[model samples]
Target: MGRVSPPVLPAACEVLVVGAGPAGSACARTLAAAGHDVLLVDQHVFPRDKVCGDGLIPDAHAALRVLGVHDEVMDRALRAAHVRCVAPRGGHVDVPGTLAVLPRRDLDDIVCRAARAAGARFAAPWRFVAPLLDGERVVGARLRGDGIEHEVRARWVVLATGAAAPPLVAAGVCERRAPSSVALRGYLHHPELAATLRELQIVWHPRLSGGYGWIFPGPGGTFNVGVGLTASHASEEGGRASMREVNLRRMLDTFAAVHAPAAGLLARGELRGDWKGAPLRCSLGGARWSRPGLLVTGEAAGSTYAFTGEGIGKALETGLLTAAALAEGGDDAAVRARHEAALAGLKPRFELYEKAAHVNRLPWLADLVVWRARRSPRILRRMSAVLEERQNPGRLLSWRGMTKLMFE
Candidate 1:
């Protein structure tokens, strides 16, 4: 239960990974196990809080299994039986799948520890200043910590810096400056709710148009509750402006006002801390995947999905992909090509999720889908498959799918 940053800073390593969340830690673990000299760094101290829904879907389970930490995570996680998807009109469907919840504070620390166990050197509370460039190629980075600046050089640099724009901009790889979406969340402790709420609850309503709210039961009689909005960039100048008039706190209030479960949770549960919000970079198109000597993974590479705003699984996947690409032993061009090709393979699935995000914009569509799912076992299974990443979400979320739903 002890959390402390490493006291020493290394002068160099073969690979330098910034941001010690799931992505960076996964990358470090894989590379370190492969006998690479890896330096993993993060700005925050160990066990720091991250803004997340904290629900681990099936895809997340798969990635954790790949990291050989699935059993450990499950032991620490609050197991969920199904997901209750509530529509705008209050119609709902329960889709069964592999689901669980563990706060990011604990989940991240586990992954970071796995990296350390695999022989990756860990340093934290170190802020990434800028990439150290040799001509057009990145050689390493300049990091400031403890009121001192240090230069850490590496043959390869991996940026797993999540959705923040400043680090991406500093590295000269930021394509869209602003985040694609945003979410606000807080923790609540209610023994009754935790005892009774076995399913993860997700509610969509007209009041939260282009967004949704969730109440995920966690261990220790706590619940993670939040609202998230997918920003509409079609009408904006550069596809970067978030909804100008949207207030997340107001949105949370609106959600509680419209949803009974949220209202009950708020009325009965004791809130743990101030509500915190974070930006999300989704759709996998915001940053360049690779420059000559560097690669970007995780939410920094837009690994979060639009429809669900889930990033942890894909973040771990992308981190592993980056590690595999670099570990294959290649020239710079070969490594870049491998990384780009790997990300390209994941693009179609991300695109399908983006298409499914239409439900976020037209929330009434959720009602329609839920109405049908309530009656159709096939549709219910499809929804479950989408959560498991076994089926294309577009198959059920598209107009073509809706048309079929009507005739069937």
Candidate 2:
């Protein structure tokens, strides 16, 4: 999170986008391409390291295509045509597609460059402090950098600044509390594992509850390994916490030691990196996305899917939708209404994913689904299509499908 920007901040812009990550970058590119004077701000410079699984699955590929950067991204990635799902009960499923793997450092830089190429001005090493308001409406943002305060006015403000949601929280747009889903990951290098690893592998053990462990292979003998789980109390029913408070460092250590996929790596693999953990804000807490001239997107808007731990694709989707809404070009309230309507169209699928996340608590259910996925190509394809956005995510929760997977 480091970059140099001009000492003097611009006085105004047509659109002020906070955060230069996927959501902000994508939004800026779309707006700039449509000929808007855009200003994108962030605390870090381009190519900064971030905690992520970094798999741009089919859905992400689709988003990049819309942004006109698909070819650029795919060209640099170590392509994997499939994501291999492995259940603790010895069943596995392979969902094939165009999946790209790269570190978030490299990926974010690629998208950010595209944003600039589209003519969006970028200001980094500048942190967002709060929203500048005109009574109840947001008209600009207050920023702090180089040990001084600066104000940049704009017609509209978008908070894509992620989990902290500082602007959103400071202005009473989002809840002023931290999200509960915490996660950690790191890279490991094992010659044997690297030589043979071809697809992303997800391990669904009963212990992870709403989350899973993943071993994603990349080029050059490196593996992106991580573990994630929500606090049980954060579940849909909101009961007492069942999973104990975890020390991510130790949990990842133990998982790598005992979990089959990483166990063998203990002796042969080198500790190529240290553990990096962060709180994952993957659920919308009834966040008021827009109020007057202010709007929120990306993780701040809860775009991440806890069930699959995917945020980049969904974040990109939200960004494009915001750009589309803004392109209609109307009053603040009108544009917001349009954006909300478009996001609402996705509620059904997201709700189903929430239910599926709750259902993941039952090991037997995961095992049955995996067992069938192993034997049934159709079941595997259905699972794959959901992430690809080619089918309804809710289909996995259907009564008929459940009955068939368990008994048929």
Candidate 3:
């Protein structure tokens, strides 16, 4: 076999999207489909590994549909009818929703291919070095790859760089130097275990007070298993409070030791590659959304949720929002205003997820919520609504919610 050649980069494009993950791919697809020149670049090639739970909820399905890749993704995913939320005290509740699991290695490639098919020029192994600035405004970017450097000047730039601070800082849009949370994940191949585990399993235990663990069934006989921990929590006075230090690997081991299902899965299954970890920027407050002639979307703008660590959906949504903002003919100020407004509209939901982070701090809260959910279908339905983004998670996971559950 002969070595394949690298993708060619254009000297200039109408829109330059850095980071070809869900957010960048989504934005590139939207813009390319709209008949604009879009160049999508990433540091790694397609089929690259990403550390994630690989659970796709309703919102992710909706975003996939918008990109016209819902069926394609579903075809390769392991479908689940609902998620089994296991509480600290062994109490559990099944919350119904449209869910699936497709590893990031495959899921991200499908989305990126969709963008290319939509006419977005893609180049891989090209990492963003810095912004090409013109008097405090971003005009383009400088990319380094293959021991060489290239520059692309565009009318607008979109940063979809996920969770990494250096690129955001170089672009002058970083707000938080540290990630809001972190997660470690790996795959296990056990045909018997994968065949029987029908629904996604998320466990909360005292051993994982700073986080939770999940075992999601994936394509083939593989399972995506992991643990995620929050770095901070929302204070009573509405400020950020740091959590105790946690060793994620020890946390994962503890999860398996404490949760029966996870224990069985870990014991019997053959491990795939080594465990991979990544940082998460959650709660949508990490960086400024827009500046003159530029916009930041995806995890770089804190698109991941606090409690669930679900970001694929919101990243796609925000990327499309940026595309729409730029597609509309407007001045730099006008485009910035539109993008910022759209992001602002989604802030309340993220804030609610942050409030729900209390469950991570106090695992007993999960026990109480699950106990209530097991008895009341109303509470169960509301929990389902949370997955659908129709109900505020803060409302359902609060003291008020506990009182309501008691009376009901």
On TM-score, the leading prediction is: 1
Q: Write the per-residue lDDT of candidate 3 for residues 282-373, one digit (tens) a residue.
A: 98877888878789999999999998999999998999998899889689999999999999999988988988888988999898899888
Clashes by residue pair, model 2: 2-45
Q: In candidate 1, which residue pairs get closer than 3 Å at backbone N, Cα or C atoms, i.e. clash?
A: none
Q: Give residue 260's error in model 1 in angstroms.
A: 0.9
- Provide the clashing-pair count of each candidate structure: 0, 1, 0
Worst 10 residues of 1 by lDDT: 232-241
TM-score, model 1 to reference = 0.97
Q: Estimate each model's TM-score.
A: 0.97, 0.92, 0.96
lDDT of model 2 at residue 211?
A: 66
lDDT of 1 at 132: 100
Candidate 1 root-mean-square deviation in Å: 1.8
Q: Give the Å error, residue 277, model 3.
A: 0.6
**Tens digit per residue, CA lDDT, model 2, 203-318:** 77766656677888865777888887754235342432223466776667666654777666555677676778876666554367788887788878877775777888888988
